[model samples]
Target: MNIQDKLSPTAKEIPPSGIRKFFDLVVATEGVISLGVGEPDFITPWHIRESSIHSLEKGITSYTSNAGLLELREEISKYLETGFSLKYSPQNELMVTVGASEAIDIALRALVSSGDEVLVVEPAYVSYSPCVILAGGTPVSVPTFQKDDFKLMPDALESKITAKTKAIIMCFPNNPTGAIMEKEDLEKIAKIIDKHDLIVISDEVYAELTYGKRHVSIASLPGMKDRTINIGGLSKSFAMTGWRIGYVAAHPEIIGAMLKIHQYTILCAPIMGQVAALEAMKNGHNEMKKMIEQYDQRRRLIVKGFQEMGLSCHTPKGAFYAFPSIQATGYDDHVFAEELLKETKVAVVPGSVFGEGGKGFIRCSYATSYSKISEALERIEKFVTPRLNGTCDKVI
Candidate 1:
């Protein structure tokens, strides 16, 4: 039987996640100081874990309502209101999902239909393009350059829109580049979005991890609330990646459409995760702030290290990633990352896997400890020194 031929063509066409490919390699190897995966190195905080333990001890393991525990939704809604000035009704406009991964997937699936095109901002999270394709929608790449700090330009965005363009999927405090879009930046892009009359899938998973400025949701801007799908989660902020707790705030109508897909496929997010998320939402702010401070220190450390080593790096304003151009090393990103891993046992993800704008760069995450990041910096500098041969121009 030709079983492969019988499978959905779309499923076959989808490539495996690039982030996990290097991660798998790191796992099979030994002594690799990894800066590949974007996950925080911190264990889930003690209090949040206690909350889950308390739930399981009480025998509360059954699935909650498909939209998730109502109390959790209420906390998420309150968090959004207090943090971003965006109000949502826990009963109708909010939903809990397995993680921001599931939230991104369902948001695309809910809004995109066959023959529709979703504009994906380039150098985005690895899943954005694939999720759009899996939803049976065409993905149109809207490239942003490093020269602009990888911010989505209004002209570049509008140029990609057409009658078939159904929505735009964008992440600020972007995954690979670690760039952020402040209120002024968002206001400009929002003007283009408003003019085009399109829906937006704004992934603000790193919203709380900014260095100096606060995150401003494009959805919070006037006239954008009704047309935006706001994605957030505890995965990064609370160091709860394994717990798989995430949420969405959108128009009630959009939430209803997404609920159909979620209830059928996921049924409900794990009840224990919902419980833990509630605890985090209510009391995890101080710990989150402490983690942010550590990330800021490491961010400065890593970016400065790259610049000193003669590789040009933008000082990331948000998130814990440092994306440095490898052109000075006379190698493309893929070759540099692979060769770095093979020679020095240091693992970093190549930028090309992220999209076209990332071709000559590499993404090094600073979500680990200060000493570990410092050691990785030493290894990276040693690896690059001979390759540049003293002719490299210092960008610092």
Candidate 2:
């Protein structure tokens, strides 16, 4: 019997994560400094961890409501209002998910049907396209470039829409590129979304991590609230990734559909995680701000280091990753990334895996320590300089 023939075609078509491909290599190689993973280097704060521990001690372990714990959802509601001026009803319009990842998955599945097409903004997070594919929808790339600061343009967006287009997935404070769409920038795209009558999945996992500008959710803009599915988490901002707590907010009917899938697949996010997340939402601000400050310092450091090494890097406005162009070294993104790992034991992801316009660039995460980032930059510079000098720079 052919096991390949027995498998779902969608599962076979999905590619493994480009980020994880290098991350796995880092794990296998000894003494590699990983700028590959996007996870924060910070531990969960004591108060948040203690709250969860205390809950466990009090025997508070049980399955939450299919939508998650009411108190946590209410706190999340307040968080949305305070942070983004966006309002969501905890009673019907919200759900606690496994991660922002699962929220993305279920939202796509809820909106996309066979023959439907979903617009994925590119140099995007690797998961969005695959998630659309798994939902039995066509994944269309709407490429954003470095010239535009990686922000999606209104013309670029509207051009991708067709009669079969069902939804668009957007991540601002974006992964890989670290690009953010300001309110005015989002307003243009919002008009196109409205014109097409399409649903939008807005991933704001990096909402609190911005440097100079406050994050403006497209959902907060006029007429966008009901058409948007907002996905968020305590993972990146609050350093609670391992806890697997995230939420989705949308129109009650849309959320009800996601919860139906959530009920069967994941009955609820863990109770301990919900309790810890509540503490983070309520009191984790100071700790989170401190982490953001350090990330800011690291972001500047990494960007400067790239420029010093003769690679062009856009200073990321938010999030902990830097997307640097390696075109100067005369090597494609994959070649540069692979040889950098093999020669310098410094791991970074090739940007090509992120979809259209990602070629000739790489993503370096600044979420690690200042000392490690410094050392990695040194290694990367040494690795690339000779290549720039027209030596057999590829020779390591």
Candidate 3:
């Protein structure tokens, strides 16, 4: 009769995300300059927002097809072709979901059975492990080195594979670390996947945000189109997080299975979001380019700031985050982040929140204004440098 007793065992077994806990602490404090959350500082483009309003004015408030509106899918198809040289048939290969988050969950659920093993590269986004576990699969964490720029190595992946391995979850232009896999690296991975007949869930939500080079999809590689599920969304690229629209493209059979699960579990993604996303695909490229350029400037500033502060940060090739090592401070990520917040009132997520290979590091999101980033760096320098001189007992 107890409410707690009635909870599912999986719910009880999973621990709260370390990242969310830090976010809660950051939110409670005033005057805190947070480089913690990984979201764009820009508002959704006016044209994109206006498109949603236009749809509402037309009284288009109804559930879209479970697969999504054909118009939106067509736009997505064209966008993919134009941007990535990827070809996906709008009719059978795509299924719109609430966000890339839902696409990840559905793909894991649809493809994995009990005892299946899911290969995850760390330090990854925190969502992947729990989703795999919830789908009755064991998550096998593969540690990637900062020395390697956190790129997923084919050898590391091959070492983790076993007969029970069902899929490899690829998050490039990655979160937390911001490492991106180049085309040659992806070709190597594709060879391994083909050799093992593995399915790949390519999470490319940050594809449009890369700085040094264009984002390459493993799905676009030779022999990979059929085995790869391309997961992308408007949230990161178009700054439409609140809209909750994302999707996946794959072979019809794979998409069909995902569609069935999505229909029963989610019914449809937000209708307005689909309409907004359609607008973005049709006319939002210029807006995305401007934002990406701004982010690139911010990225360079943050990386430079960290290096000047005596912390070694891997110059992230993509995404909006900088993962800087805190080892020189003689503190773990959790301790370093807490002390930094308490002393400098600058909040950042501890890298350990992203799992193994993330210890002694912290993730600083550059999705804020340049002035804020500068001010935060000043505070960080004042708080951390003196500690090294033994002038302060701690960062505080």
Candidate 4:
């Protein structure tokens, strides 16, 4: 009578999230400065919080339609059109989801079947390959490198295509790496997708957090509107992660298929979250700008700190992370992260958890306060300096 004997193989096979494990370690350790989690440190904007409060005050805590509150969906449609020049019909082509995470899950489930292959660009968010496996698809890693700023090249993608390749799961303003694809880069990838007749799941959760240039949705590219599933939410952009609201925009056929799954699994996103999201769309722009400005400053500080410490750090143009190579320390990613945590009481995610290509790197989040980031940098510098100088066999 073993419970494990009856579990689904996929469910049993799935590994625990590496991010959560490090997060837990940080929580358990005393006096640790964590640059691990990718969540924004800012609270939800006042107006957005007020909207959710007002909704609760009015006794409006109930489920909306399975597709979500029509008002919210309409707002999402308008947000996309105004921001990215992408158009989606609120009625048939868009559905509110629990989070961008859920949208990704349902999109993969809807598009992939047994023996189907989903091209997952690495180093990607931890969820991508697991969700693909859960959906009965084989995840084929198309690795991108640090030298190239981790941008997914058309040649790399083209080489992986086979008749079984159904879709590509792409995340720009990528987690861990913080790499973003320019319009020209995406256009090239889009051309390859068009030629191969493959679909794309564009996870743009960090779209609004880009620094220098604006984010360009692949769905907005020529001939790409119908072939891409656009996923986004208020989590990264508006610091509303706890609100748990996200949405998906795709062609009617795909939306309709995803809706079938959503209806049964999650009838609707929380009504209060929808209200908060609606407020975020209408009034949170100014607040978001302020937060972005702060994140940009922190981004520069962290990347520069790592570079000055002998780590080859990439300047992230989007997202609040810096993936710095720890190769000079002569330690693999996991060892470096663990030793740094133990010795310096600083928590950062090991890049190896992201993908194989991430082995020599470490992902440091700059989403915390500026003062904390500066302090953490000082601490990290102290820890890695001796190792780089070859004066200490162990970094403590």
Per-residue lDDT over 1-396 for candidate 4, one digit per residue giving the tens place of the 0 to 100 score? 999999998998899899999999999999999999999999998878998899899999987999999998999999999999999999999999999999999999999999999999999899999999999999999999988999998889999999999999989989879999999999899989999999999999999999989999999999999999999999989999999999999999999999999999999998999999999988899999999999999999999999998999988999899999998998878888998899899999999888887888999999999999999999999988988999879432
Q: What is the lDDT of candidate 1?
A: 0.92
- Per-residue lDDT over 253-347 for candidate 1, one digit per residue giving the tens place of the 0 to 100 score: 99999999999999999999999999999999999999999999999999999999999999898888999999877787887898889988889
Off by over 4 Å in 3: 394-396
Residue lDDT tens for model 3, 1-396: 799899999989988987788789988998999999888899999999999999999999999899999999998998899899899999999889999999999999999999999999899899999999999999999889899999988889999999999999979999989999999988988999999999999999999999879989999898899999999999988999999999899999999999999999999998999999998998998999999999999999999998998899999999899999988877767888998899889999999889888998999999999899999999998877976666766531
Off by over 4 Å in 2: 393-396
**Location of the lowest summed lDDT over 10 successive residues in candidate 1:** 387-396
Candidate 4 local distance difference test against the native: 0.93
- lDDT against the true structure, each candidate: 0.92, 0.93, 0.92, 0.93
RMSD of 1: 2.5
The deviation in Å at residue 342 for candidate 3 is 1.2
Judge candidate 3 at residue 175 and give its lDDT: 90
